[model samples]
Target: MKAYSKLTREELQTLVHELKKEYSRYQSMEMSLDMSRGKPCKEQLDLSMGLMDSLNSDADMCCEDGTDCRNYGVLGGIDEAKVLLSDMMENNPANIIIYGNSSLNVMYDSISRSMTHGVMGNTPWCRLDKVKWLCPVPGYDRHFGITEYFGIEMINVPMTPTGPDMDIVERLVREDESIKGIWCVPKYSNPQGYSYNDETVRRFARLRPAAKDFRIYWDNAYGIHHLYDKNQDYLIEILAECKRAGNPDLVYKFASTSKITFPGSGIAALATSSNNLDDIRNQMKHQTIGYDKVNQLRHVRFFGDIHGMVEHMRKHAEIIRPKFEIVEEIFSKNLGGLGIGGWTKPNGGYFISFETMEGCAKAVVDKCKKAGVKLTGAGATYPYGKDPKDSNIRVAPTYPPIDDLKTAAQLFTLCVKLVSAEKLLAERTGEAPEKAEAQA
Candidate 1:
């Protein structure tokens, strides 16, 4: 368990030889396993089968507000769905807008609206000379994808366990007028499952942005995705904090039942201030008459309430927690003292962020792929698919079978060792590759 950084060139070369044998055996197996996406395994997906039964030919179709869910008139959402998602999103029912199946879809539309219109009547971003966005590094890829799709200049803000570097955040936001928004996965964040502490939440609330339209895109996707019953992450509710700080329209919060029940079929919602809701509704009225109220009713009737959804998530934990443990144990057993890398062990959320030696992440991923395994591309966690250090690979363990993940994880560690050793050997000879290996 000695640190690999302390090893002599000869020792490193010997380890590389052994690791290559292991890698070769994996290659011979031709095992095409994938650990690239944070999708629920089959068993986890099966836990919500009752959702299909919740609605049928003879079920009650009218919500409490007298609107028949079969037809369409409730632009915001049905009252029952609003109640259900409001509690889940930790906001007032009046502040919630139950969108269609995908939260990502709603986020995309929000950006699109801002581009054509603008936030709360600021100048349209599309007409502006330059529109910029602050992105938290080692963050969600789709968040970056949204901003990138809109042609917004993205600035990377380093993330700490507490949250993004708030000093720099405050400085840039205070000084820059074009910085219109920032993407945040505030609770049990994607890739690394770190939650922002109370101070970070307060700091976010108190931000003095130069742009009047500046807002925080708080995608609390994993707010209730706890891996343990008793040990869970608690995030200070951003909507309330913004209100308390007199920045009532400073944030927009989103969540869904994707992980709890179904992904593409789940109900997604956004929570924000009453003023913001009014503003969004002005345009939302034109987007659709309403979303799928029948599916929303099915979700509400199936879960019954927030408590029911939480109980269902516990079932998911039972099925997938062992898979998480298996991967973590394998990593610890194989690479505990190797100073060449590090990784995050999160209590909840779907991804484990793995770090390889500087300039070695793409090489390790390429080695694993050649051995018939797939991973999230090395730079996916950062803005524009570029990790400046060429490290930080996101390892997703929830999709594969447990036994398969173990083999994949071991093969992954072997690649790590081989790549690290090669990097270290190159360093010993005062040589480094001018151009790094890019993951295909």
Candidate 2:
């Protein structure tokens, strides 16, 4: 119950010895648990088994517009699918383009297209001398990975509870012509589960970017993923807000049914201004005849409308809610008021972001791994796998069962305490003057 930082060197040493004994017993169990990826558990995935039965060999293959889904003609998507996904994406069907199963793939291709050809007749990014993107810290690693792969220079913008710092964002974008894009999770953001409030969204829409081709890569991946029905967070629709700000082409929004139905077999979509969609279509036409309309049709038939999708997400919430609570409960019981670490209690989303004492994240993660618990690498939440403070660690509790997650969370807290004690003892004995100065 005592704060680890207040403990004397002798007390810390005694505590570490006691924890080591507890950890030794845990090691004897030889558990092989993984809390690395934000994946749906098998029970949650089972909720979408009905999708397989939605289409069959004997089923009709014609779309709502009478285009044969079995053929390759609908470049954007089938009519019914557009309607379904439009509702899911919170945009007009006319402004939406349904892609294949992966939103990440759509995101990658979008950047690739911009790099090779350019956006709306701008110079191709490949031809430019410098291209940059603003990335929010403690964001989705995959989002950072995509931008990093394109060799785009990424600048870290600090994320507040409401959203990323808007003052810095506004200033940078207005002054820097090479800052072409920003990556945003917008609603129920990855790792932190923080959503952009209306004011933040408005500020985002009103940004005066120096680059004419600037865009916001808005990945609304967890827009509808709420853990509590009553205590839910809302995010303003960026595309609509941009239009209201007289910047209709300032943002591109992405969504997918990957979490709703199947991870790799669901439908993905992009919503943007008509002009941006047109520009994308020009490049899309050359890429292929069309994306998989069959899977789109399957998704449409399975979730008839936005309401149906919402109802289904409630089922996923039921399955993962307990797992999330278990982790929170363990953290609260073990690490509360410890002055060693802190973690977010997200309303919805797949991850809990833990902030360890400065420079202690890698040690905590390494301690966890040595005890047979696999976590997302400590620095993964930042751009280039480098958490400058080495203090943020992402905890994904959704993929494992509740019992397993409880154990994992317990192990995680033990690591936090152990590492914190070591850090505190080192500071107390003047063994780490540089770290002490860094803290000061």
Residues 1-440 of candidate 1: C-alpha lDDT, one tens digit per residue: 68888888778667767766777788999899998889999998899899999999998898876778999678888888889888888889989999888999988998999999999988989999999999998999999999998899999999999989999999999999999999999888888888999999999999999999998999999988889998888888888998899999999888888888899799899999988999999999988999999999999999899999888889999988899899999999998887878998888999888888889999889999999899999899999999999999999999999879989999999999888877776666555632111110
Q: Which prediction has the highest lDDT against the true structure?
A: 2
Query: Over the stretch 1-440, how does candidate 2's per-residue lDDT look in tens digits?
Result: 78887777788768777776787777787888999999998998899999999999999878766888988788998889889988887899999998989999999999999999999999999999999999999899999999999999999999999999999999999999999999999888889989999999999999999999999999999989999999999888888889989999999999998888999798899999999999999999998899998888888888888889999999999999998888888899998888888889899989899999999999888878888899999999999999999999999999988778888888899888877877786778777733532332
Candidate 2 deviant stretches above 4 angstroms: 432-440
For candidate 1, the TM-score is: 0.97
**Which residue pairs of candidate 1 clash?**
none
lDDT of 1 at 309: 84
TM-score of each model, in listed order? 0.97, 0.97
